[model samples]
Target: MIPFRFLHAADLHLDSRFAGLAHLPAAVRSYLRESTFAALGRLICLAIKENVDFVVISGDIYDVSDASLQGQLRFQEALKELGEQGIPVFLIHGNHDPLDGPRLVAEMPEHVTVFGGDAPGYATAHRRRDGQEVAIVSGISYPTAKVTANTAVTFSRKPGSELFHIALLHGNVDGDLQHETYSPCSRKDLIGQGFDYWALGHIHKRSILYEKPYIVYPGNIQGRSVKETGPKGCYVVDVRENGEAALQFHELDIVRWQVTELSIDGMEHEAQWVEAVERRIEDIREADPHLMTVVRFRLTGRGNVHRLLAEKGAAADLLSELQRREALRAERKEYPGLVWTEGFAVESGLAVDRSRLLQEDSFLGEMLRLAEKGEGEGSREELEDIISSAIAPLMENRELRRLLSQVSEEEKLDWLRGAAELGITLLSGLEGAGEAEGGFRDKPDGGRYDED
Candidate 1:
């Protein structure tokens, strides 16, 4: 076998609207809306720059099954450029863009080969230099959006082919819980097949499930949400003549998503909060000076700032001020890149001395003890029941019911933490009011009214 190389990418998710982020500024929103397309452009540029023999997109060419005309036109134009460069592209349709879905009126370039859903399709890639056949590409597309059957069993390596074989698939491996269990198949099922490389999709986090005959998922080219953070990109696989393949990852995302934390442990005033947050934003911009960043700030730890944050609209004011500052900088072109604040979360508590309170045999102590107990492993089931009961009415709404079903246990625990902190702060405030009025004193159980 001769040495060859190819670009392996998946989950382009073009035309992603970046849902759940509708509150962003018009300029930032527009940038996010076109981020996926910009990622596609970067991918095309990388392919041409590397001068690879071919390109393999495992699945999910569009964000939705019924892809938009604009997305299709842009995609076709990019592929046409690849065709002009004499580079072939082999791709498959995942659940997001299945074969049965509606599509644009335009046709794909001749150099592109889209695998069908009837069976595992096959193609041969020829090196443009000498026109020598290098490798065999095989894949299958989803017939519809919801595929419940195990599609991996249907694939078999070609008979008597000495060429390097790459298999493309878009399905859950062994029922990966992170993603929907569509076209479920086990890693054993894939490994048993004699294919040289497995170009996978569906799950949008990159992973190399196996090596030797490499099984890989290049993740999505662009992150559509904050949950999918960090650098998003593709892989360039260089196959040595001896069949040992080397992989190089490249970042293609234009706009980045991040969740940053700011500790208010020693903070004494509101101005300090503003300065600290601004510093964190500057650090993010400096780290990636070229890319635009959308960050969610989380303020943590017990401090005086926590009491300020407890005030109605305090957190909102802080977030607004930060946003206004950044917007002004952007307008004046003060910074080389933009760092937009997505939202702020004040997960802090009142700066009370917990040790003294915990020692007292009063209502405040009991409350603190119970809050600690709630964080233990044994309390999870009870906490779940309590939280579910509290939110039962909200869950009764059809949309909210469906949305709540998708909320993870970890996120629910965060809500519990925030609630506990708020309860503590409110109780502490009442204690302060009682002392200042000289109307009450701490009793064994709780506060008591003083005798005249």
Candidate 2:
């Protein structure tokens, strides 16, 4: 009936280069580069503050490609600090930091217990104040980078073990659209294993897969790209004397990647458009005066702004004005700064009504139908092929390749939607539907790259 606490975290991705964003400002890049380590520092600080019995790191401690000594040394120092505080660290190596990973060059501190790569490792932590056994955490590290098996099914409660049981692992349970199926297990497989808690890694977004005997994914400590938005961090868990468990999340991401949609339906002039966008930018900077923020935007809804946004070079001009404004504010020290737009997409539908036009068998109606056919025609793959062929010329750029590497399908779809909007605008102009608005949106999918 002993009560205890532990911090569960995963996917440190230490020293990982912020992908899909090779063109951010130097100051922003510098902050992003150190964000993963900072997240670790925050985790360590939280551990000390909570006086947790131990800490559990599911996996992916560091990106294997970034074999920087700074990351290694920083990791060593942080664990050493926890050791000095008499707190134990239990961790497993995920695919990104497999036992054979090239980036893992440093030794762990004495207080850290890393589950072996060959098999699942076991450890028991004793409460610092009372010296009573709080729990036994079982973990399995990846022997190599790609392990595909139900690793969870391989575990069983220790022989007559009389303590709380926790399991640590790095794998895909069932399947994930956002990630590869590595070391795959099943939810039922994990739950039936009789482990009191499962601290998982690999997947970057947090999810509570089960209750009672808790199965949780703590997600990554820091978001590396636009695909990873919102809060990112670790979980603090308390196992009460009656074995009732509770979890609370702490934010560790120093830079938050976010996307917001703005409606430009009411604006009639260019000045109004600029004012509306500048106001939103102000709101973003005010969101957190303390931390840096990278944002992407989706300008949605049916409005004249959609036609303007479809014009060439319009998106860049908009972003430039925003950047200039940011610089002015920062120079005058009028605002506590640290915000920039990574990219944006214009998904606005055409402002003109086509319901009556579609009643006639006209070219405009056919164009509109074809443009939206992907929504129902099962022609998405076909359209993707056409789009890919058209944009292949731009893909030759190395920077473009790297930028798209971390982009998710969901984000990519935003660009495709913008393309459809542009098509609608072009067709409207051709049909003598008056002057099209010059407003434009930019997407990372070759929409508009920031030149500044």
Candidate 3:
């Protein structure tokens, strides 16, 4: 066995649109458009700096099924850079960029090996100094966008090979419900294959499923949306003389996604609210320092600030102020120091005593009692029925149906809770019904994007 090193990355998602972010400023939107490309460049630079023997990308080199010309060109250019450095790249196409889909004509460099879809293809990495065989890479690409068959089972190790074996696959393992269950397979299906490492893709969040043989998912090179948060990057695996592999993660994302909750419990004045949010933003900047962070802030806890936030245009005004401040900060810095505000979810509530209100015999008391009844009885079915009825019209509208289709059951339940809270706030006379803004209201199937 020969000692070697390689970089493992998956889910490049090149030329991502960063959709549903048109509400941001032109400067931020323009930066986001190039972030995916920047992340890819960073990955290639990392591979060169690490001086890895080879690079393996499990799947999803492009964002769409029909790979875009721009994405293919950018990917080709990056691969050429690696090829110039004498580093070989073995890549496979996942569900996002299947082989059967249309792609622009961009010839790959000699050092790049794109695995075929018919069966698992094999590529061997050799030492540049003496041409000694080091590692064997086996991978398969998706024949079409929908790969229902267990693609992992198609791979079989070369019998009695002394070189380290690495399998690159893109599929759901053990039925992870978070992503589309394409090419589904179990852990038992992957283990005991004589492979030294399993390089996987498709699920964006990184995880190490096993240790002895090193089953790893390096995740996407960039965070495409707020749902995919934290540091996004690839792994550099070092194969020692003893045939044992060691893995190290290196972040390559240019723009990071962050979700945070800020309590407005003690704040009585609007200035305090602004200062508190500013402090949180500063904390996030201090942590990331180099990368631009897109934050989804949730305002929680009971306070007088909720009363103010419930007023028309109050939250929007605050958001604008924050955006302006960050934009100015970015203008001053030579590098990316900006923390773009994606929007705020005001989950804060009034300071009224719900228990005290429940004891009264007024219309507001009856409403509170009914809310308690619904909550205590676990009226999930009833809430679902109400939500479905309210959203039925929105579903009928072809324009909004696509957006509403992503609403999860958890989100629907959250909306029901928000509706109950808003009803109580209105009935309690904390804010005038006429003054209550649509942005503050709990909209069925459209809660997260009520803000601009």
Candidate 4:
């Protein structure tokens, strides 16, 4: 029986432009630009530190359309770093970087083994620590960019020995709408293959499908967009001869992109709002001491500043205040670390639980009732779509296709509550109009009067 360790990482998506983030502070932008390389460096460093038997990168080494030569060269350097440690790198071309890949000018290292061809390819490597054969890894590179067939169908048929059989695949196991469903397969398709472990890529969020055979998706090495908020990194898997493998995740992102929501409830003045936001920046700096941070603030809950926030230039003023705070930090030589406030939104309403209005029998109550329709299972998803598409054009960030994913999580997608308050604002603007709900609205999210 042989025991070994390996690093499973995927969806490098290197040389990404990281578009839609230009408005962030220059320092944050610069850190983000270099964050991918830093993350990859961390992965290599970990492999070297753990003396892993081998490293497997499932797919999407670089973006085919936007990949740069510099990105390729840097990638080569990282692989070379791993190669120097006698760490065999097993990689496959994902949809982003197909077999007939872009950025072909860069040279790959000799120690790196890329599984090519449409058919699943098998490669075997011995443990660097011992001479014994460690594991047989199987992988298939996407020949072309637009592969629609089930790539896993080939995995079931791929040949491998009894020793820890690991399969590297870059495809959607199920019908996940978030990403392009290339090389589609099923969880049953993977677990049923009897492979000792499956390192999956293509999806950006980390997930573990099953444990018996050890199927995993390490997610992207770096968080490239706001939708990719939270800690982003790779996983280290340790396998024993005849036991369940132990897995640990390590954070490798150089910067953290977080959306911090502040409640202005009980606050009285504009100065209080600035002071509160400043405190949040300080808190983030304390928590993520070394890493740069880009934050998008959302004001929620009952507040005196609701109308102030809704003003045309209110968001701009808040942005300036944050920038001024950063400048003061630099002047006073305080945490000089980079913590930036990119943008913000106002979701707060009158100092009242608007749901109570829904139960009323008046015009405003009727509006609340109609707005609450989307909260139910019958109309929630429909309403979500309508709001997302309607305001999709007004959004400053164009990377995300939907509003909900960009703004908040599923459980907290209660922006509908704020919609009720906004309806009141619109209704007030309508000069006592009995009813409202028509005409074009250019504001982000939705129209105020269109609600109540």
Candidate 5:
């Protein structure tokens, strides 16, 4: 029986510049681009400190098509240090670094073995102190960028052997959505091969598909964008003599990206809105001081501020003020850094008068009645067409159309409710003849252009 530990990592995307990082503060942009290599250094240090048996990099060690010679040399230098300590490194080339052209494997340390894209291969390493031998790893690289068939079937575990077996693959599992369908293989397909563990890559989010045989994705070593938020890192797996494996996640990302939403529905004053936004930023920074957040705020519900936000130059002025406050806070060291707020996507507007419309004996009223009939035993499509035709003229009206466009989906629904309420009030107040022409009366609450 033998005990060993290994670090499973994927999607390093090293030496990659995030073009979007330019939107962030200069300090933050520097951190994101430089931190990736720094995190890789930490990973190597951790492996040395933990005295792990080996390191398995599933794929995408570098982002460049042909990685810089300096970058290649630096990587080889790190591998050389591990080789000096008698630790072996197993690696596979992912889509980002396909095997067919401009190879760097030749420059790496002798202890590092890279699997070629042509065929599946494995390397054997021995536990010196105990004299127990284990199959260190097996994998195949991407011959070209796209692999549509099963790469797992080409790999088979050693025959009639009880030694620990692990397969490193840089491809998609049966149902991963974030990545293209590359080197597609099923969980059953891998299990049938009798491997003890499957190291997967291509998906940036970390996940554990099965624990019994330990199929896992260590996620991306760093968060590249808003989409890749939260803690990004690798997994350290400890395989015991009894075949029971224990896994622990280690934070390998130096910089992170996060999304937070702020609601400005009830905020009536600019000061109050600023205060609320400041509070939210503080909360986010406190949660993760190293986080570079991209906020997408939604201002919903009915409020006077909605009208102000709707005015020309008002929204732009608010964004500028918010940016100034964020900068000040960051300068004072109150918050880590506000990358940039995508914007306060507002969804607020004036209430509509619906009661008056319902009381009218016009075509609009008849359409509203049909709409209110609800999803009954009728053709929903036909009823929707009628309702659409009825509302088309109003929707096409320039002022109403502009207001509707300014508000959010939910706020538009609220405006519809207001129209219904007003229609009801006018209907109750009108006599027979007056009610007939009520639908076209130029909006009693000071016309459609009124401040309300």
Candidate 6:
């Protein structure tokens, strides 16, 4: 039996536009761009430190269809470092990095073996220490961006070989929703192929669908958005003598994306709100001190701060001031190693006084009544259209739009409360009676009337 270790990594997304990252401070932006290569360098260092036999990069090394020469050279230099240390590297092209275009890996070091986008291809190598031959790999690359049929059907375990077999594939498994069915295959298909390990890629979230043949995704080395939060990186697998494997995740991501929600309901002033936000930030920093975070905050609840948040430009200004103060604090060694707060999303505003609105028989009240009636008697589509139109102005407003986009659970509950109040007030007004002065009053005919 041949015992060996290997590093598996995928979805580098190198040189991709840091779209939302522009809001970050200049130093953070610089770190983000450079962090992709730095993570790859770290992966190489890990491989060298662990004395792995070879490194397998499943796919998507670069983000652009036409990759930059500088990016290619940077990757080449890192791979060269591994080659100089007598370690071999193998790779396959994924959907993002197809093979029909200019080959980026063409001038790579001799130790690098890239499987081209052609018919079934495989590689055989021997372990130098034990002189034991091993069927190291088999794979197919994406010829073009779209591949509808299964690419794995073409590959089979090497015949008449006593060595342990492994297959490297860059395709979506049957259940993945985010990826196209490019090079699609199934767990059953891979397990029946007699391969010992299947290194898979194209999905940015790491997963292990099957363990019998060891099918796995190493996920992306770095997260690009809030959706891809938490620790992001590759995996290190140790293949034992009896064909068993042990997998360990290694986080190589330098920049982290975090979403945090802070409630300002009980807090009386903006200073308290800032302190609350700072406390939350400090908590996250202590939990993951090395992380460079892109945090999104949702400040909510009914309080004096809520009125301030309702005013135009006030919420944004307050958030900016808070971030500036925190940044300054970080600079003064009060909170050392703290990265910039990328951006602030206010998911808070003044809780609507629906009862007050209904009492006045205003246009908003009429709209709410119409919405409720439509919801009860109208078709689903009609009801949806009515509600959407009723909320159109709020959605169109830039500040409200931003707030609603990242609304927290408490904000949602507040909205529900407002809705309930509106419903009750509308019901009361329908009981017709003469107007009175402030609050709701009962008329002689057993009806309730709202006072103006």
Give the higher-lDDT candidate: 1 or 2.
Answer: 1
Candidate with maximal lDDT: 3
TM-score (C-alpha) between model 1 and the true structure = 0.80
Predict model 3's lDDT versus the native.
Answer: 0.81
Model 4 spans > 4 angstroms off: 21-27, 105-107, 157-160, 324-336, 352-359, 366-452
Question: Which ranges of candidate 6 are over 4 A from the true structure?
Answer: 20-24, 103-105, 299-304, 312-314, 322-336, 348-452
Candidate 2: tens digits of C-alpha lDDT, residues 22-52: 5554545566688889889999999999889
lDDT scores of the candidates, listed in order: 0.80, 0.75, 0.81, 0.73, 0.68, 0.68
RMSD of each: 10.0, 7.1, 6.4, 7.2, 11.6, 12.4
Q: Compute each candidate's TM-score over C-alphas.
A: 0.80, 0.80, 0.80, 0.81, 0.72, 0.73
Q: What would the per-residue lDDT of candidate 1 be over residues 88-184, giving only the tens digit for each residue?
A: 9999999999988999765677889999998998899988788899999999999999888888888888888899999999998866566888888
Candidate 5 lDDT, tens digit per residue, 342-372?
4555544433345656567886686466546
Record all residue pairs in model 4 with backbone atoms less than 3 Å apart, i.e. clashing: 426-449
Q: Residues 1-452, candidate 4: write the lDDT tens digits.
A: 58888899998877666655444446445556777888888888888987788999999888664468888889988888888889989999888888776565645677888898668778776878666887888898888887889877677533435678889999987766678879889888887787888999998889998888888998888877555678888888988878469999988887676777888797667778878888888899888887767677777665555556654356567788677766565455343366767566665554554666667777888867766665666775767675666576666565454433545435334556555667765653433222222222212233221100
What are the clash counts of all predictions, listed in order? Answer: 0, 5, 0, 1, 16, 0
Badly placed stretches (over 4 Å) of model 3 are 328-335, 352-452
What TM-score does model 3 achieve against the real structure?
0.80
Candidate 6 residue-wise lDDT, 259-329, digit = tens: 66676666667778767777777787787777666566655444556555544345566557656765564
lDDT of 5 at 315: 55
Candidate 5: which stretches are off by over 4 Å? Answer: 21-26, 103-106, 128-131, 290-304, 307-452
